[model samples]
Target: MKVVSCLHAAVMVSDLDRSIEFYTGTLGLAQVDRDLNYPGAWYQIGDFQIHLIENANYQASDGIDLTVSTRNPHIALGIQDLEQAQQRLLAANCVVKMSNSGRAALFTQDPDGNAIELTLVDPERESTKKFDII
Candidate 1:
């Protein structure tokens, strides 16, 4: 069997407001739904929805959530071009970390340090656009 599509993306945010700002304001993801009175918000990232949930109460053994999971536990987002995504991330002040050997992949982080990767696929092979959320 093959995976059909991505339903949603979830990120544990330390500060929900800041995370919302980065996702909605900076990243241009629209607010599909949000429980502002509560502790969560949902954003429309292309066809998939990104869920930002407040999780400051969580405390791991390391006591530092910033660099705990470093085995590339992140969502690999596809972009029209790697260079474009890099420029956008740089403009938004997202902390860029690494890039693939082929120069077609790059990594960045959210306000809560959740890794978000951008990959560029050759159009001849298979391509997709970074949709504009409506």
Candidate 2:
């Protein structure tokens, strides 16, 4: 089978409402679509859509399908402005990591402690490729 594109990504959350607040309020993700079928919310974060669904019914004890490194299968968000994104994350009480090149990246945990990495996109590289700004 050929992999055409990623339709969306799912990250189970303990609290649906708080997850919605974090994704929509703190991160500034737009509510592109939603469904009442389950305890979850869908958000548009740039090019890709993220889904935060309730995990209370999950049978697994891990709660989430993630590793201790928090590196595998991470949702790395690209921002238009690194400084501004860093400032926003800092305002939200997130820990920011500044690079030697002045670029900043922030690591934040969801209500479920899922690691999320947000970074600033390099303008030069973006101009050379098909980069999604939305």
Candidate 3:
């Protein structure tokens, strides 16, 4: 057996509506139709998907620093423009921290304290297996 690729990431949240707003409104992700029986939301980005599960008693881990710290575990997404993304996040009243490792990357969090990282992705360099400072 082999795990070829990641299917999706499921993060627990407290409020479904608030999380949906954060994921959709703030992150600019479109909510896809879901058939699950539970309270949750699914967002598709290219081939990857983010699953948000609503848990009223949700508890965050210690890594929920909500700051610019690549040392913590967070969802990292490759985007075309880092500066633009940062501006959008700031406009949405989200706390953003730029990567201090000389890389075009930034960090932010969702309404539920889910850490998210946005990094500039070069299509040509990505195929060459180039890595970021993280």
TM-scores for every candidate against the unseen true structure: 0.69, 0.71, 0.86
lDDT by residue for model 2 over 5-114, one digit each (tens)? 67688888877787788788788888876747877888875456888879875432344333232333457777777668767777887544543233355555666666
Candidate 2 lDDT score at position 56: 75
Q: Which order, best to worst by TM-score?
A: 3, 2, 1
Model 1: residues with Cα > 4 Å off, grouped in runs:
1-3, 34-37, 58-70, 122-134
Name the lDDT value of residue 55 in candidate 3: 95
- What lDDT is obtained when candidate 3 is compared to the true structure? 0.83
Score candidate 3 by TM-score against the native.
Answer: 0.86
Per residue, candidate 3 scores C-alpha lDDT tens digits across 1-134 of 98877779998899999988888987889788999899999999766799999999997776666444687778988887787899899998998988767788888888877888888887666654553433
lDDT of candidate 2 at residue 96, scale 0 to 100: 49
Write the candidate numbers in order of decreasing lDDT.
Answer: 3, 1, 2
RMSD of each: 5.5, 4.9, 2.8
lDDT of 1 by residue, 88-123 (tens): 888988777546454467777777666776666545
Which pairs of residues collide in model 1? none
Identify the candidate with maximal TM-score.
3
